[model samples]
Target: MGQVRDQRGDHIRDQSDDQSPDESTRKETSMQDSILQEGINEVIGTTHLNAAPMGIILRGGRHTLALFKRSHTAANIVGDGWFVANLIHDPVIYVESAFGDLPDDAFTTEIIDGTPMHRLAAAEAWVAFRAEVIGESSEAYSILLTPIKEEVLVRSIRPVNRGFNAIIEAAVHATRYIMNHDPELEWLIRHHLALARKCGGEREKEAAGMVERFIGEDSL
Candidate 1:
């Protein structure tokens, strides 16, 4: 057994890296089958129990995370060696989490392989993975995560909603614009906001309003 400290300097028990060779192979196969699409999803980490939107990539049939070096998600995963990847479709979740730490009520915990892990309460599905930081650079770290456990929480089938899609795009741009102050990103945010207002449902409209408040662009 081993232990690591989160960003808050609190000790957390590390999940053992030891795995039977056959067990490792089986888990890898499962990861390739389910995580076929590479896209953005909310990642919940134990460091302050924070949730952040991150991109999950499928490279050579293995799931990988290229995390920013300065992010709380990176710090938490580096220290804990494990985290949960949430498949969520709500624009509210994406917008709220992109801006700041979500309220405590938004999360729930489960014990996976004896280690308690945090996950989004509204995730459509969830996967538990053990991560290894395989590469690093000045700006970010490349991580390889293998699925150890997974479950589907919601099974609803719905048609594609462009309004929801627009809100997601807006949320992504809003987060980047806050950090870099790039004028292009702001323009993109407004463009997406317009799409949301024109095409999105009530929830999407609400999300667009949140994005406006988030970036101090009430003029939208």
Candidate 2:
């Protein structure tokens, strides 16, 4: 009787171990599906408000709407860099607005410049900015869409930080391509440099530098 009980226990343990990965994988897939659906809903449901000429849109209510518009515009043009930058910068504005004070004029002015450097800087600064904003603001993070296994996989809805990171990654690749062959836009290069400074993190800074080096002054 003892031997039979031991054999049954071993069998159950083996089955449980075998089932774990399958269960985990199913849960992950379901979560991914939900995320992907949310992204589609956002893109489809919202009206595209043009803060600028780009195809970006501003979502949310009137108060922070302009900021969202501007941030989206940057993201559309530059990708993740803008998202990251905005995540950092939004809190600065929030703090100023809360205290009935204004943010540094320089910071606001630089954001309008919309150069690559400025964009990069915005992305860098956004890392810290996002944390503060999340702490203070009720705004929720956005979900990300990625291609996986013949369907769009959606990851966790990140607030501005993750959204910005996503945009930065895309922008970096695009910037690299543009820098390697097309170099007439000196202004664009400067803009990217400004963006690099905003990135604040070492990896982002390095990526921005790589883009800058690729488009040398001589080439431009």
Candidate 3:
């Protein structure tokens, strides 16, 4: 993986508003075309994507648990031209949003300027979902979305600190959703759980409990 270049810099990419009329139209057309996938190569999607922060932690709100809640926002230029889905979540949360079916087609693996971003296509979107069991019945909702223009990496990662237990509680929480849905990520998920186990014993029981509740033996 390539280094972040320099950690002291505040690298932000907010292209939604800066594009020229023609350039923006072209990009939009390209993204829409890519999504159709008549013959885009799978390997083209892997470019510069090997080194990206896999998951992120989110701070949720009260409506997060309540109905009409909105924590995460998915904004997009739809076939009709615009779409928005305001979604909510837990107080301290983990979210696996920017990914979708046909992974390669979902994001553009381009490093525009210095930031790596995927020009999410029509079928590709940003969404946030959460559910809770209400006795015998469980209610769930999803927030369909568009990619964000900017975000900060909480901490730059390196081989030295990217160990199993190195994941924060929020990382575990966010990852649970992805790990559960994608069987291919089983090994990566187990590695995080094993790290949680290592941080076990009474001292780390709270953390361990998090693992159990989310991805432990019974949960898995």
* Clash statistics: count for each candidate: 0, 30, 4
RMSD (Cα, Å) for all candidates, in order, is 7.7, 22.3, 17.5
> Model 3, poorest ten-residue lDDT window?
1-10
- Per-residue error for 42 in candidate 3, Å, reads 30
lDDT of 3 by residue, 1-220 (tens): 1111110111222222332334453344222211111221111111112111221112221111111111111111111122211221211111122121224553443343344444333212232222121111122222211222222213334233233233443343334344345554555555665664564444233443443344443333
CA-lDDT, candidates in order:
0.69, 0.26, 0.27
Off by over 4 Å in 2: 1-186, 217-220
What local lDDT does model 1 show for residue 158?
73
Task: Give one digit per residue, the lDDT tens place, for model 2 in 23-98.
Answer: 3543442223212121111111111121111111222210011112223332342243222122222322222221
Among these predictions, the greatest lDDT belongs to 1
Q: What does the lDDT come to for candidate 2?
A: 0.26
Q: Spell out the clash pairs found in candidate 1.
A: none
Model 1 lDDT tens row, 42-139: 34333337887765665455666776767777877888888677887787877777766788878888887788888888888888787776666666
Show model 3 residue runs off by greater than 4 Å: 1-14, 17-165, 169-180, 199-205, 216-220
Error at 213, model 1, angstroms: 1.3
